[model samples]
Target: MITTTSLKNNRTFIILFFFLLSFIGNAQIGIGTVTPNASAVLDITSTTQGMLAPRMTTAQRTAIASPADGLIVYDTDLKALYYYSSGSTSWVVVSSGINPRLNFKRIRSTDNLATVLATELAAGGGAKYVLNSNTLYEINGTVTFNFPIDLNNAYVHGLDSNDDIILRTSGNIFEGATGGSIRSLTIRAATGSVFNLNGAATQNLIFRDCIVANSASVGTISGFGLVFLSIINFSGNTNGITYNNISQLLLSNMGWFNNNAGTYEKLTGTFTLVEKQGGFSQVDGTAIGFDVSTSGLTITGDAVLESVVFTGTNTAGYVKGYTTGSYTGYNFNNSWNVRAAGIPTETDANAVGDFSMDYTVGSGLAVSFTNNLNPSNTVKVGSGTPLTTYSNLFRFSTDAANRLRYQGKKKRIFQIGGSISFQVPGAGTYIIYIAKNGTVISQYKIYGRGQILNDIVVLPLNATTELVNNDYIEVFAQRYTGANGDIVVPNMTITIK
Candidate 1:
């Protein structure tokens, strides 16, 4: 691993090195066209004129820089220096301090070889050499490159190269064969390092879009960096509204940080909402910068979240339920009052034809379920059959005015949640007289719309309190339809908002 401490903090050293190379190149130490035929030849007391100057038939000395070098001597009368190359496979006595053919040789060969012992004698072991088009083989060792503390617009590929290669924009993301792993770093600005997944891949990597404004630097020496389908930083600005729409959407910025040692540290930036279409992301930790806030806003829809949010400050919501009962312009605890036709002396063709009273609904709303009645069938109010006559009495009971007596037999009533049995009253439409028992209560209806049902009758609980001396409990069909009378009632459902 390359230690950050190894980096020279002295800017003067770098600038000075540049000056020395420039002046030395133009000055003349000794004038002549000195050249060497062999690869590892060295000479002392050589002139700068002999080493440089154009148009001279001088073999280009492979000017290579080396970390390891061995000592060599030219003539005892001249200065001394050492030289090494793959050819000699050992150090050779070259020009002394007078002409130091660099102690190292630029091994420019395309052997595609691994672990080649090029130089035999040296201060250190064999120095790994690299050329423009040549591969820097890792061979049997791991190579680690630290990030430039002040890199510009670089991102963590996180999977691009084992050797440290901070990916720039596009194109160069993946050039040739990449083995091992390459990780990446993230930033607040849009540097555009996104990778093209459509291209050929030789390494493994994954870059996930973040939900925070700023993420930290990329971790690890990457073999390859992955940046696909990702966005840059964002500024959070949200609009709070409420309405019913097809869908609702929410979005957040990607959180980023740098690792100090192995601990991940936050990167700095402002948090803002961006236009991510219908996408949403939730990330942990803060983008190092201040002024970041938490967003708990809600978006609602059957499918995925779009741009709008329903049932939230920036969104809207709706209601649904069952519509019940009718408005007779009277607010009374009207129990399900059912009445059969009076016993008429004039019988239909055959007395066997029974005349019982049944109920049908009115436009206003409501119902009554008096099926097994001791009384017969007959229609009233506006005479014969009407359109409202065919409504289903999801719940059934008798009229409250006349009241009811519970025979203790369970009467089945259908409702939204399910079905339940209860004791009502009357042969014609009875009332279950709960007068003996103290006050008792029940949720008239709940699965859905109770507002509409409330119109016909407020819970008669208050009414029961005002019950006169003979005031008992009974069922009253407000304007519900589909009962036993002139109308043939069957399964029917009523829905409301």
Candidate 2:
């Protein structure tokens, strides 16, 4: 019933109507299968092939204009999948395997450290960066930071020497709230600048093998254990640091060279120094190594110093302790020449034959001569007097007292030997004994006899005893069985070594 041309036109019209319906309905297009997944807009399923993303070099990928967030690209330079992050405003590398370099945020001297740290914090969910202990952050140029870099409980290590990483800043460059450490770095601060500021008291901070130079002040440190090892402070306006309300401050092998101020000031707790070498190389008469002279600056505990050497002229001496404070414990040992004002110098050992006392009685005693061993006067031997031969550790009470007091800190053994020549009024027995604090020691009592009246008798007293701090020793003689008449004592000599 229809012609051939009419049939062909109807077939074309039906095909065009179906194509327009598919376009208007937003249909999914599948290449290999008739049914496509509902989640995908374009599904290409093949058994022998995979989908290929847009591949470009790092430069080409960055050159893309106005790239949308979540834009994916295969980076040929990094050999990793890169995704654009709008929050960080950079391309983030996506990898299934762990990369060691990801743990470190490499910073060049030209790079803005604040910017780099901010980006790193954003990527790390605002947590502080943890410095790797074994890694070395080599900085070639001077890195100046305006804001404080808070090292939240991490060990920041630099190159082999402090000269490699030079930091210059006007304000505080480093701070820590919890705990941290910095080693092998040189910091140069201008006026009104502090090198480090600690915020907490329960935590500790340490600095080793570092140089702090030309600063208004170092920083106020309040912690449990603040330690400085092999640190050098050069040319600063004030002291190296101030420690307040701390538990312990230990300094070992520290050198303060040509600094305008002292090494430490405002010290408030236990301080221990070992093998410390420094002095006022500038020959500042007012400079001191440990300055506690400021009013109300008191150390609450002991200060132990060992093997400390102070070279150039320091008119004020090396250390100054608070006189009215409760800081009385000072222990020094082994080649430490610390001239502390208003504090006694403590030595480990006395010189050979240094502490010796000698006394002699010139006149004779009356009847019985009970306990008359106390010398009436001192005898001069060579160019030294009786008391002059005694060192600072030993002191003679008076001419007739004949008592030696030990004023040293350590306990020592002493040998006491003397000869007493007396004429007994009647034949009997006599005893010569050593008394410590008015108590006669039974083992040191020596007995002698006088057979006839006016008989000359000699008694030798020798004893060894241990003497502690503040102990005094004396010699006494008593007539046990002699007549009550006058007993003449010709000569008596006592020597303590």
Candidate 3:
């Protein structure tokens, strides 16, 4: 057994056995007996039919044979996804769809309104697709939009008077389908291209924060029996991002560009008028007082100019509109930094001339009156609602330095009397913020003691103050508590005037 000839034969036999093991082992997948960079050949066999061919499990070999349909294909890097038809087995990158998201990977005809995006392996194998995670729907007979529902429901048909189907996405352009709502709901095509819809009679549409540049495909828009609010570029004018012109259209709160690029009627920088077929009127405010903003501009449309009995030149420059309302002419103001008043010329006077409203006059405690405010100097409380406990008091004041104590006041500069409440503990600094329509107007900081009633938490924001008429005022207050404060506030009485 220990002979040299037998030992040599055993070594040779072991070496040959190792080569056989190499071919069968799944642990290591190599190309061939050739070098590591040699061409790869896969030997994959399976009993299943119509099932996917197994991919090359070997990482060392780069290329893998494609599936029969080929749509179930994928690349090393996932970028574009595709679908392979079982019949023709062709690939489709774009399918009729809606609401696309980043993970969206594939496409299919069974898609409903809620079915959103489809995506998967970049190489497009496995025929992967993703549906709308949040689903969509058309409405049943319920006309009102109580809330959004699944889009796939059959009763959610989207047809309007003109027989155009409309699709509505929040903060998105309204693209009508073939037979539901009016087609004019889509983005306009080009300058002067006509999109006449004067025959429409439906709901008042509120559109905001959008763009409608003129397109050759969708021309100038003309319409009837429609209320349009805040839709930019409805006029088919390419110049301004937010401009619109409609015939027999009711408009409100909507800003328009001063540049009269394409109004069929003559317009002035001061006033731009259009024909009013259906009577229009609102809360009148003309000539009660002059607005602090711009002056001396032209007015177009049904707006009135100086009316005269005869052709004579003996009257002062004055005009009134058919509607009993006054409006500010176009103002060239780009800055939002509204000024603070009662600061002795420190406020930017220029800002007052840009806004359509007036500037503030003095400092404040604050006041509230729901009914009527007489006594020009007094804070009149009519009957709004919700009387103030100690919780609703907001105060803002300054110190010896001209520097404002409230950094928020410095940023927003002014506000309507909103609500302010506070929590005082021992002695320290407290900050109060002022706001107008939920926006930050100003802030004030105070140093004081809050040991009055520890358990009794007093809400901060108190008397809501707002200037009547063109009236406006700046509010100011000081926090008596020092930095190291533990001060107690007595029943604080705010002086309203």
Candidate 4:
């Protein structure tokens, strides 16, 4: 029923449909435009439309079988984009948003710490990032940060203690914050790098098991509760750590503030409580350790120092406390060796029980013996009477019966010098000498002749003697060759230099 012309038209229509299908398979495909971009496989140019990615919950995303490494998805639970990191074998968040799964951000040497901190701040949406108290940011290698980051309450910890985690910075690395700690890290910088801890007076900060080295200065610490424990190798700095307006500071198990260029000043401005314990050593340096002579150094409450050793050839002397402001209470233990200028006069009870060696200049006593009774007495030849009624005793104490006693721990050579005023009963030669523990020291005896009776004769006494602890010193006079009568001692001044 059909002609040969109709059969040819049907065959031509089928050939044209097959050719267009092959052309569509071999060429680029474009939507909403005639020509697609050369770089793209399927280019969809649009002004009022957007492409949609696969969206799923966290459990659904994790259930994908053998997902590709570069697979991107929008997380409904996290409300952010996440990319599958094959190297880490986890899905890392790609947006600057808070990831509850990530407790801490691990930083390596190759990672830019500044950028990571910036991301954290962006996630926090504040001027300073408030770090999680339970989080510990582990630093593994030498991380360099060019700018400073304010971490409000952060704990930056290192994996090793052998300077493996080095934080090298150009300027002040940590800005002021409160109630956090940095531990087991090596903080390094160039010369004149000021590492400041200028938090508020009510805040607290701590550093433990860390090394701050390579010419880094611990600048202007002004926190209230600051603690440093087991910090060693802190040297080569331009100046020691300065303090201002601190309340409670504890430095324990510290080693080697050695070879520093400047003095470490004491706490200044409202320092209420300070305690240094557990073996603090400062060796091989010309710098002064714990210099209290700095202007405005004040201790308003209490300071306890124990087991602090200082060994150096510093001319300024280690652990100096001179002309300081008011300190309410100080309890220095037996191991405190302070080379100070103005030390308080310890009482007799305290000095006998707790007296340590003080290497001070002109270290000795000056006492005066006055004859308050002034009684007329007779003395036979080759006999003496002990001078009594002591006054103005410095570094020397008196027994219950009034005898001068030395209260030092070590034996030292003391140059004894004084003048004794006495009245001989008659014209004769009198012998006055120093007596130790009621025994006359023969070499210290001085001979004087009184020309008339009832007249005063002043005799100069000078000698050098070695004294130990509890050695009581006294002045005695004997009638060598005179009328066997009394020689009244009116006044005697003695100085042991």
Candidate 2 lDDT: 0.57
The local lDDT score (0 to 100) that residue 288 gets in candidate 1 is 24
What candidate 1 gets wrong by more than 4 Å, as runs, is 1-165, 169-193, 198-205, 208-363, 366-457, 460-497
TM-score to true structure, per model: 0.21, 0.56, 0.23, 0.49
Find the 10 residues in a row with the least total lDDT in model 4: 351-360
Give lDDT tens digits, candidate 2, residues 243-349.
66555566665666645675544465343322233322332556666655555543344444544455547634556545542123442322233342344545423
Q: Candidate 4 — number of clashing residue pairs?
A: 0
lDDT of model 1 at position 403 = 23
TM-score, cand. 3 vs. native = 0.23
Scored by lDDT, the top model is 4
TM-score of 1: 0.21
- What is the lDDT ranking, best to worst? 4, 2, 3, 1
State the TM-score for model 4.
0.49
1-497 in candidate 3: lDDT tens per residue? Answer: 49999999999999888976864653333433233222334433345533342232112112323434543333222233344444653443323322123322221223332322212111123232111233222221212111122111111122221222222222122211111121122233332232322223332223333334433322222222333433333333423221132222333322222221222122122223332222111111111001112233323223211111111121111112112122133111221121211111111122121101111222122222222222112222111222223221122222211111221112232322222333343343333333232333343322223454342223333333342222233222234333332212222223222
Q: Global lDDT of each model?
A: 0.23, 0.57, 0.27, 0.60
Deviation of model 4 at 393, angstroms? 7.9
Worst 10 residues of 1 by lDDT: 346-355
The candidate that achieves the highest TM-score relative to the unseen native structure: 2
